[model samples]
Target: MNWYVVYTKPKWEKKVAEKLTQIGIECYCPLITQVKQWSDRKKKVEMPLFNSYVFIQIEDADRNSVFEVAGIVRYLFWLGKPAVVRDEEINVIKNSLKASNIADISVSQIQVGDKIKLETGAFSNQNAIVQEVSKTHYILVLESLGCVLKIKYK
Candidate 1:
């Protein structure tokens, strides 16, 4: 059996994993603990490592088992088709994440004050201060120009 990434409906990874397991399909949904502070009290909560997704090990021979699960949006798809996630990659992802003491914060994936150096262009060698970080680029304070410039980190 090979592992496959399953995209689930929003906030449904655990729901889907439970449903899948009920039908006898093995699945993995890594979770982390986080403290949720409310106006009145704080509570610790466990949340999925990857929101809206889980990894399941199944074979093309057992495709129907996956479909039997409710709330699985679909086996992750490519251009109009299901895609396969390799066993090794899945093992690496699962092991590496499980080994870390992860906190389940809904913080932006990108953070301010990230230490980065320009890799290319005229500012190649300069150490930059990340003024703002975005999904597509980092707004950096170009010390030489005394202005902010966005660099595509991807």
Candidate 2:
């Protein structure tokens, strides 16, 4: 058996994985917990790390069975065949996530000049241009208001 990546409907990775598992297919959907803040509270939500993709270990004979599951779109193909993932790589990802706390995970790839929104705080929903990037904060320019503010990494 080999691990194959399957594309799923938007926000359906976990549901598809569960359906595959119910049919005795071994599937893995890596999730990351992200804390989102609202005016009243902050909540931690688990989101799929790979977005709309799930991994399933199966032989070629079981391909149709995977497609039968709702929300599963198709298998990711490489070189005209289903792409195969090494077990070692999967184990590495699992172990790394398990060893980290929710606060330790950070995704910071926004570049200078990227248009972004202030999702929280006083400027919630306002758009800003990233004026500068530092190790732990962003200096953004609110062009409409002609003001610059530094936002700390969340």
Candidate 3:
């Protein structure tokens, strides 16, 4: 079985993962704990590490079974096919979260128009082209993932 990326409804990642698991599908929704502050109080909440995305391990022939659950929009596609995520890539995410020190990781200097491979974060191990860079953020085009990523720095 290969791991496939599933696009979920906004804010439905956790719920979708839960429903998938209940139906005997193996799913993973990476979550991170963040402190949220409101006018009245501050609280630590666990949020999905990847917004509107969940990873599921299933046979290719059984791919359509996922739609039985609600809140699933569609499978993320790349190059006219469902995007496949390597098991090692998934393991990297799991291990990194277990360590909980990923925030301390840093990247070296990069310039606009440079092709770089990310070593950490959600897009780790993927190649990206530097589209734009500024003092506040970096805009990267991830061809493999079919999306642009904006990374903010202080």
Candidate 4:
């Protein structure tokens, strides 16, 4: 068995995992509860560490089990094929998710035309290109969106 990455519909990682598990397929959805505070209140809510993505451990002999799960948009790919999830990368993400208060953050200092790299927190090792800057965030361009988006900072 090997770990495979799957792209899921927006906010559907948990749902997909639940369905997959009910059918007897092993699924892993790493999550953390964030303490979000408003002017006078605080509450904890669970959120997926990786947006729109989930990981599954599938045996090469049972790959079909993956296709049966709902909300699975597709597998991460390169050159029109499924991509393999590196053991090391999965280890890092798993270790990071185990820790709490994962620094709710969004890069806003970076402008639409500026370049930025994660300086701290969960995203520290990844690089995302900025497309637009909002009062509270930096809009990142997704390969599919062909543009940018705003993400709020902690």
Candidate 5:
């Protein structure tokens, strides 16, 4: 069985993973403990490391079985196919989390001329090429949309 990514409804990553596991589907949802604060007090809460995403191990034929659980929106697709996660990559995440001294982890570095996909906003899911990178903004060329976009840092 290969590992695949599942996109879930907002704030439902843990729930979907739990339900899938109850149904005998092997799943993983990496979580981190974060300190949350309110006017009165502060509390530690576990939050999904990757929002709206859960990883599952399943065969190609059994892909649809995950739909039996609610909150699972669909499989994340890349290059016109369901995105597959190698077992080693999963292990890296697991091991890094286990290491107490590690304070932060960055997924990747975006450089000029790199091809990237926008994850949110008006260009959501659209692919673009990095034209220029600045301290406050990025100039990207969206070939699919036939336009250049300048995203400024907030």
Candidate 6:
């Protein structure tokens, strides 16, 4: 069996993985626990490590069954063939992510004109570019729609 990457619909990684597993498909969707603060309280939540992507181990004959699952867009194809991920590489990703704390993984210094994916809030999963940076916030520009958003970090 070979490991393959499947592209899923927005925010559908978990669901697709679950459904695929129910039908006897071996799928892995790595998730990370995040502590989020709200106005009244704080909660810990699990979110997909790689948004819109799931890994599956299967034989070539089983490829068609995978695409039948809802929310699965298609297999990630590279160079006219389904992209195959090595087992060792997948193991490294899983092990590294499991050993690190959320804080250590989340903090990164982004610069102007750097593109980033919004992981939380109303702009979740949207891609934006850094326009300006302040002490506790970033002024981001959404290029596709020509709008600017001010996002504050806690």
Best by lDDT: 3
Which stretches in model 6 have alpha-carbon errors above 4 Å?
A: 100-154
Clash totals in order: 0, 0, 0, 2, 0, 0
Global lDDT of each model? 0.65, 0.75, 0.83, 0.68, 0.78, 0.76
> Which lDDT tens digits does candidate 6 get at residues 81-118?
88887675566457645553322223258878899986
Off by over 4 Å in 3: 103-106, 117-143, 147-154
- Relative to the true structure, candidate 2 reaches a TM of 0.64
Model 2 agreement with the true structure over 17-107: per-residue lDDT tens digits: 8999999999999887889999999999999877788989999886888878999998887678887877755674576457533223222
How do all models score by TM-score? 0.58, 0.64, 0.76, 0.58, 0.68, 0.63
The CA lDDT at 21 in model 1 is 85
Which pairs in model 3 have colliding backbones?
none
lDDT of 4 by residue, 6-61 (tens): 88999999999898889887777878788998999999989986787787878878
lDDT by residue (12-104, candidate 3, tens digit) is: 999999999999999999998889999999999999978999999999999999999999999999778999987876785687568733444
**24, model 5: CA deviation in Å?**
0.1
Model 5: pairs clashing at backbone N, Cα or C within 3 Å: none
| TM-score-better candidate, 1 vs 5 | 5
Candidate whose TM-score is highest = 3
lDDT of 2 at 32: 78
Runs with alpha carbons beyond 4 Å of true place in candidate 4: 37-41, 100-154
- Steric clash pairs (candidate 4): 106-153, 139-149
Candidate 2 positional error at 147, Å: 37
